[model samples]
Each structure stands twice: as structure tokens, then as C-alpha cells.
Target: MDAIFNYLDNMFAHLPKTEEVVRAKNELGQMMEDKYNQLRAEGCSDNEAVGQVISEFGNLSELAEELGISNQYQSASSEDKFVSVTAAEGEAFIEKTKKAANKIGTGIAAILLGVISIIFFSGYAEGTFSPTLGGGEPNKIYIAVGLGLLFILVAFAVYLFVMTGITTEKYEIFEKKMVKLDPHYKLIIQEAKENHRPVLTRKISIGVGLILLAVAALAVSGILSEDNEALLISLVCVLLATVGVSVWLFLSGGMIQSAYDKLLNEGDYTLERRKSESVVQRWASPYWSLVVVVYLAWSFITADWSKSWIIWPISGVSFGLISTIIHAATSSKQ
Candidate 1:
């Protein structure tokens, strides 16, 4: 049934969408549905019924003259091609994206927590551990332990990121080309997005609120507990940890949202936007690659996880502006 609808959508996709054409599509859809149901009643399997119905119905252009819409069909022949997505493909893409989101969120959270671990051991908890987990001179051995833990966490986070990329590589075609979700699939995705929207909104709000609260806590501790070094260390750790969680929520929700918009051709993935940004997108790969390098370099060199994370948001915003300006310039030149 869905296969039939997808075929119908593809058949009419390039047409001018005049009143005559729309009526023709609806009439054809009803006829196809009835035929499919009849074949099923006559003992045909679902696939058999769908195949038989499509075979008999042929294509919209073939039946255009019979349906009295030859004009629209002929005129739309020069229209650009759009790739139609199947239910299976759509479902797979969304599921994969959801998983990818979790991986990315976890990886990001691990990096943030890894940084906090350094502070945890080297700060208030300094000298809390012996040099060899035995009775030894209590040096700042915990600092070395913390750095080791940081590297281990970071390595695990990197692994998750790499696996996520491998998992989602198959869907790169959808991102690289113009895509159209069948009406039925579009409705399903729309509903899913709507259902998830409130949760996403709440997460964003609470995440930002958490970050703000963390900052407030740090400031208050700094002022009132200036003499209390341990308290200050705890509050700074608390602030970064809060920021980590908030960032995790944001990335997770944004990933799911991006999947829906990509399929629906909304937001940044609209047909015209995709076409215009084709050149702009080429720049994105290398730009983001550089960002990764910069992030790693800054983090390892300065060992200042507190300030290093700030580069990410700044890079994101700046890239948006840069891409927009470039897109506009290229478009104007045309």
C-alpha cells in the first residue's frame, strides 16, 4: 500500500500541480487502492497485489492522455529529478540518526566529564590518593591519575564518534542529493517530530537553565567562599559538569530534529537551500575538520577544558555566518 502511494507521488512529483492534476492524482490513488484490495481478497499476497496493481496502472505519464492531463505531464518533463524515499529507508534513516545522536551525546558528555575528573583529582581531592594506591609519600599522584583517566575517557569518546560516522555513512546520499519523502511517510515523520517536539523544547530550556545555574553557583561560591579553596574547586567542577549535561541535551535533541528536517526538506535542507548551499557545503567538510584539529590542539596544549569547549559554540556560530555570506555572494553572482 505504501509502495503504491510512493509510486504515485513520484509519478506526479514533477507536474505543475494544477487543479486537474491534483484531482487526477487523488482519483488514481483511489482506483489503485481499490484494485489492490480486490487482488488481496482474491488471495494475492501483499507484494503480489501491489505489483499487479502497479503493472496494470502503469505510470502517470502513460495514463496522462487517458486521464486528460497530458499537458501537465508533457510540460513537467524538463523538471529536475527528486529522489523518493521508501518507508523502510525513511524508518531506517530516522532510527540510525537517533542512535547516532545518543552516541554523539554520550561522547560529548564523556569529554566534558573527563575534563572535570582532572579538576576533581588535582583540585580539592589533591593528595587524596597515595602514589601507588599503597602507603607512599602522598604527592599529587592523583593529578597523574586524573590525566590518565582523562585520556582514557577521551579515547572512548573518540571511538563512539567514529562508530557513529560508520553507521550513518550509508545515509550520506540523502544529504548529498535532493530527496522527497512520500506523503504517507511525511505524515509519519511529521507526527513523530511533533510528538518529540515538546520533549526537545523542554530539554533545551532546562539545559540552558542548568548552564546558567552552574555559572551562578560558581560566582556565588567565588564571592562568598573566597577563603574556602575546597568549596571553590567543587563549585567550578559543578559548573563544568552542569555545562556538560546541558550540552549533551542540546546535541541529542538537535540531532533528532535535524533528521526530520532533512527528510521533510524544511529548515536548512529545503530544495532551494540545498541547491544554493551545494557549493557552501563543500566548504563545510574541511571547515569542521579544522575545528576538530583546533579543538584537540587547544585542549591538549593548554589542558584547559574549561575554556577549550567555548571554541565549539563560537566556531558553530561563526561558520553559520560565514556560510550564509558565501551563499549570498555566490547566489548574487548568478
Candidate 2:
């Protein structure tokens, strides 16, 4: 009986707080008690009855599934019969919800502040402010707005990092409990987590690339227009494209690649065969190598040595070098 109680406690430790899970555990306890009484009636020893009950209880996965905790967003309800268990679960549940809300609030505040700063500074810099408010060149106001936006973006990222830790801890606890319920699911989850990286990378890269192409097109078109308004629109379009590229690299592409590369140490497996990697897979090494050579050659030919500004060619050279390395390494490995 003590052994059974210990096992139950261990199982609950992995589960999130939910009414359905509590009810399931309570049901298991009752079933065990009934089984123990029946064994005693049949002249079985206390230890023997306890062992029988443990063996008969079966895997916890079905119970876990019934409780509807497959994802973080779902919650389960319990009746008055499990009030005590619900109280314990409630605290953890409340904590998770509060953390999520705080994260969202911080993100919203950052975005709103950034947009408002831009609008205010844009209007003021363009000399559109009313008599009471100070006015200046649009450029000066825009520069100030940019600084404020940058600060907000940095703060928002820090808040997100902290929130990530809390959610991940909750997920770890929930996963551990689920393992006792059904061991087979652990393998499924492990595989999914591993494969998610490549898929995420491919999808995000393709999406960002498309967006950049669109924004660049809009910028170029506007730049060619006769209207002065077109110049402002073109500048905005270029700014948007630059921001998109930075976000794609920082948030999506780099993170996904890091995860994929980490798993490379596990076995002889390479990330080349992942589902979203088909585009990269299809491109022959020779073709990519040629691309790198062409870009590198073009960058040097187009360099303007007179002006100290060297961002464009420098970026091009870096891309070419990295692409060349990936191509060469992958080719030899294949």
C-alpha cells in the first residue's frame, strides 16, 4: 500500500494542475484500494495485495490523455470530490497564467511605445506639430524615435527571455509526469522536437526572403517615382526590408540552425535530410560554389574605394564566404 502511494506521488509530480488529472488519480487510488480489499478477503498477505494492485493499474498515458493536457493552452475541470487536489493544482496553474500575461503585456507595451514614438517624432520632425508642441526637421525627430524604438525592442527581448524560462520549466514538469503515464510518447516527442528545427528554419527563411523581396521592390519602385512623397515612402520601405532581414536572421534562421547543429553531435546524422531542407538539398554544390565565386568577384569589382562606407560589399563577401563553406563541407560529407 505504501509503495502504491509512493508511485502515485511520483506520477503526479510530472503532471500540470488540472481537474481531469486529479480525478484520474483519485480514481486510480480508489481502484487500488478496492483491489487490496478483495485480495485480503481472498486470504492474501498485505504485501501481496499491494503488489497485485500495482501490477493491475496499468500505464498512466490513457489517464493523462483523458485529462486533456496534450498542450499548454488546454485546461481541465474537476468536481467537488477532488477539491483538495484542485487546490494544489490551482497554484501552479495560476502561476503559469500570470507569467504568460506578464510576457504579453510587456511585448504589447514595447510595440505600442515604439509605434507612438515613431508617429510623434515623424509628425514633429516633418513640422506637422501644432503651435504648442516643438517642431524640427523630420530627420531629427526620426532619429530620436529610432533610439526610443531600439530601447523598447531590447527591453521586450529581455522580458521574453525571462518568460521563456518559466514556461519551459512548467513544460519539463508536465513532460516528466506524462512519461510515467505512457513511456512510448517520450520517443515520439523527442523525434518531433528534433525535426522541428529544420522545418522551422526552412519555413521562416522562405517567408522572410519573400517579404524582403517584396519590400525591396516597393522601395526601388518608389525611389524611381517623380513625387517627393515617393522618396519618403521608399525610405520607409527600405527600413522595413532591413528590419525584416535582421529579425529573420536573429529570431528564426539562426535559432533554428543552432538547434539543428546541436543535434548533429548526437549521431552520424546530418540535418540535410530534414523535411524543410529539400530546397538546400536540391541545389547542387557546384551551382552554389559558382554563386559564391560570382558574388565575391562582383563585390570587389563594384567596390567604391573613395568613400569609407563599405557595408554593401562587406555583407556580400561575408555571405559568399559562409555559403562556400557550407557547400564544400556538405559536399565532401555526402
Candidate 3:
């Protein structure tokens, strides 16, 4: 066990300057040292004890591989823990964002189609088509083009969803391996539940990402045009995303930063500290609720009636509100 511990410590000492991998390796080395010390107290020889522990551990090569240490001696510690609590939450958020993008894309395509149809009808009712296509019926071509764009966007969304699933699997496997390496795994999980910082961070990232993403969608729908109704809707999304992020930071930053500061001071990871998720969620819920309401109201007012798309924003807001309420209620219980 001492030999194994020494080997691990030496391995970590030579690894590249990655804090996470180094930290995990140090933690593992410490555990090995303590275990070896205990066995020695029971009168085991250095060779016998080392042999026993090495056999028990199976292979250092496998341990290094599982921990993602490319060169058993290199540093890659940050990859051990989920980069942040928000990482998993980010996955779910990204999935929702992709769906929202698809819906927005589809809605814009349909509206464009309907408008072009109206244009063609109006032109036919009169004497000739518009000068844009040299007085020809460009309606069919426009419709086909709009449909093609919509399909392509839809396919892109499907691809994002698939990639999200794959990334999620990789994260889960990495998380499991981290737990295996850490004896205090359960405590860390409980701490995460109580902290809630990671989750909030994820929501914040998602909201921000969506807002930026909506810019492209807005350009597609002509919302970037001055005084367009779509402009107002796009503005609303931007505001919601911005407001949500601000609220998240307000709720989470101080607490998470304080905890992190303590970690930095300690210079080692410990799973003893705990906080309450309810505390953070309660502070954030009302603000999020307000943003949700504003968004829904905007969506309801701006959606096109000809397309019967009024329900989209309403449903989105309702769901967001319900989820927030549920999270608040559950966190309080915890």
C-alpha cells in the first residue's frame, strides 16, 4: 500500500498542471497512504502489504485510464467532477433551447408561406405579379424554399438533440467513475443537492444561450427590421434571457463564491460542508416567475393569428411557471 501510495503521489506530482485531475489523484493518494498506515499498524511487512494493496487495486493503469489521465503521469483533474453543477442542467436546458429554436423556425416559415400565398392571391386578383419576380407567379418557388429552410432547421435540431444525449451519457459515466474514486461521493452529491448553485448556473447559461440564439431566429423572421412586430417579440426574448441570468447570478453567486473561497483557502477537497438548495431557489423563484409572465404576455400579443400560433408562448410560460413553482415547493420541503 505504501508503494502504491508513493507511486500515485509521484504520478500526480509529474502530471501536467490541471487542478482537478491533480486534486483527485492527491485525494486517492491520501486514501492509499492512510490505508497503508492502518495495515502497517497491524504488523504487515512493507512488501506483503504493498503486494496485497496492489492486488486489491487491480491495476494502476486501469485507474489512470478511468480517471482520464492520458499519460498516467499527466494532469487532467478538472475532468473528474462534472465541470460544474450546471453541466447536467445545461444539457436539459440546451435540449429545450433546441426545441424552442425549431418551433420559432417553423413558425417563421409558416408565416412567410402564408404571407407569400396572400401576396400571390392579391397579385392574381389584380392584373400581374410583383416586380420582384418579373410579374411571374413566384409563390410556389417561395413556398418550396421556405419549406426547405424549415426542414433543414428541423434536421439541425434533431442533430443537436442526438448530440446532447451522447454528451449526457459521457458525463454520466464520468460522474460514476468520480464517485468510485471518492469515498465521500455520497456526501458530495448531497452537498450538490443542497448547494443548487450548479443547477442555477445551468439555467442561467441556457437562458443566455437561448437569447443569443434567438438573434439568428429574429434575423430570419425580419424582427431585426425597425418597428416590426417580430422585433418586439425578439426584444422580449432578449429581455427574458437577460433578466433570468441576472436573477440567477444574484441568487447563486454570493453563496457559491463564498463556498468556493473556503475551498480555495483549505487547499483540499472535503465533502463535509453542506448548504440548502431551498435557500437559493426561494430567492430566485419570484424573479424567474416575473420574467416568465412577461415573456408569455409578449408571445400572446405578437404571434400571428392567421397561423393560429397564439398558444406557443402561453404554453411555454405556463410550463416554466409550473416548473419553477414545483422546484420552489420541493426545495422548501428539503
Candidate 4:
């Protein structure tokens, strides 16, 4: 009976580790064991009984089809074959990439807007624009800063609205209980690693290089230019270039990472990892929203735009700490 079960395990090892397949394997083993025992009781030798039991059981291909595990097996019939799991994983990966692009765009936009607002209001305070408006009167400066803050808040709200739907959709895929990969999955993964990884690495390198070059150019332009208007134009060009490279990197790099996850049966969708991730996801958005509110209120009350930028890095660190604490507490309770 142990030998029969071991043979069955070896036979079906190529299939994904799903619940239905596991149940079918157990039932089949029991049936085979009973048949083997019946043959032995009929005065058959040990070898004869084993042979008879296996022969009577018939071919595994037909049984695999009945059990819905035929998808992993190669067959002459095309209709019986289902789509590859990797294909679905690919679509999910693309969605994740789009979500990442949105996140990056939102963050970059906010940072750029913050810097622009500071520069504009600071100049307005010193009468750099429109000398006729009382030469940087405190009242005028206040109005300019107020308008800038309003723009920033509006941008943030729009970002949240647009990205919430994308984030929710991506999470839906991650929440699913993924089965283990097929035995042959490693072969396909090996091929992908050989063929795709080098290309992806090169593209990422190029993208990063472009961004760095743009930043360096912007820095040099700012340092050399005595004219504020010319420096602003150069900064805008640099920002556009940086954004293009960033989008390219996010799309390409995300797909590569997703491929690795699918092949290795690891990453966010894996059972153990998803449990901790779910807890963090539940609290992250609200925590960040509160942080944003605090940041804006503090900046406005104190009129200290320069120092208020520190809130973002502090909040990021605090969010990680909060996630760790929540995970520990939940794990201990469980």
C-alpha cells in the first residue's frame, strides 16, 4: 500500500498542488490498495497481485482527465487543454505595473508641485514677480501660498481617487490562494531567466542612467544660470525626461519580477506572505491620509514650507514601524 501510494505521488508530481488533485490522489490510492489486497487473498503471489492491481487500475491519462488535472499533461486533443497559469499571472503582473506607474506619477507630481510652489511663493514674497503688487507684501505672499496649497491638495485628492480603484483590483489578484507550480515549471523558468533577464537588466540600467543624466544636467543648469526663468524651464525639461524613464522602468521591471514570482511560487500571492500583507494593506491608506492632514495643517499654521518637507520621510518610517507592530501583535494573539 505504501509502495502504491508512492507510485501515485510520483505519477501526479507534475500537476499543480490543488485541493481537488490531492483528494483524487488519496481516493485513488485507497481503491488501488483494496484491489491489491483482494488479489492477494485469491491465492496470487505478491508480484502477481501488484501487477494485476496496477493493470486493472488502467492508464493515468484518462483518470487525470477525469480529475481535471489533464491541463498539466500534454495531449493530442486541444480542446481538453486549458490555458497556462502563467498567462493569467502575466495579466496580473501587467495590472501591477500600471498600479506602480500611477503611484510613481503621483509621488513625482506632488514633489514637483511642492518645489514649484515654494519657489513661486518665495519669489513672490521678495517681489520677483509683479512689482506692482506692493513688492512682496505679506498679504500677497499669503494669498499666493494659499493658492499653491489648494493646488497641491487637489492633486492629492485626484491621485487618491484614480489609484484607489487600481490598487483594489491589483489586491484582488494577490488575495487568491495560489497553487504550487507544476514540476516542469522550473524548466520554463530556467529558460526565461537565461533569455529575458539580461535584456531586462540592460533596459533598467539605461532607464536609470537617463534619469541620472537628466538630474545632473538640471543641477548644472541651475548652478550656472543667474536667471530664475531660464532655470525654471530647464527644471521642467529635466522633470519630463525623468518621468519618461521612470515609466519605462516601472513597466519593464515589474513584468520581470512577476515572471520570477510565478516560476518560484513565491511573492505576495503565496499563502504565508499574503497573510501579513493583508494586515498591512488594511491600515496603510488611512494612516497615510492622517499623516497628510497633519503635514498640511502644520505647514499652514507655522508658515514654514521649507521644514515641512521632513514630514514625508518621517511618516514613511513610522508607517513601517506601525506595520511591524501590528504584525507582531496579531501573530502573538494567533
For lDDT, the strongest prediction is 1
lDDT of 3 by residue, 253-308 (tens): 43343333222222112221112323334555586567546643553465222222
Ranking of all candidate structures by their TM-score, best first:
1, 4, 2, 3
Output the better candidate (2/4) by TM-score: 4
Worst 10 residues of 4 by lDDT: 76-85
Model 2 deviation from the true structure expressed as Cα RMSD, one decimal place: 16.9
lDDT of 2 by residue, 9-123 (tens): 7667768767888888888888888888899999999767766776677766555557776552233222111112132343354345445544554554454344334534444
Task: Give the per-residue lDDT digits (tens) of candidate 4, residues 1-334.
Answer: 5555655776677777778878877888889898889888898986676656655665567766667867644652353322235545644554565566556556555554654466456545644455554443365655577457757756784776577555656444434444333434333444555676677777678777776777677667777874664355546445554645565575556555654564454554454555676888889889889987988798778755545655765887788798878777766766
All candidates' lDDT scores? 0.78, 0.50, 0.46, 0.61
Residue 263, candidate 2: alpha-carbon lDDT: 27
Winner of 2 and 4 under lDDT: 4
List residue ranges in candidate 2 displaced over 4 A. 1-146, 158-202, 226-261, 264-320, 323-334
TM-score of 3: 0.30
TM-score for candidate 1? 0.68
Model 4, residue 241: distance off in Å is 11
In model 4, what are the clashing residue pairs, if there are any? Answer: none
lDDT of 1 by residue, 1-334 (tens): 8888987886688777777878888999999999999999999998778777776775556767766777765654546445679889988898999899889889988877887787677652333233334334463576678778889999999999999999999898777566766555566676788898998999999999998888798788889877776676677678777877887899788888888888877776776677677878788889999998998798678755445756866897899899889878866776
lDDT ranking from best to worst? 1, 4, 2, 3
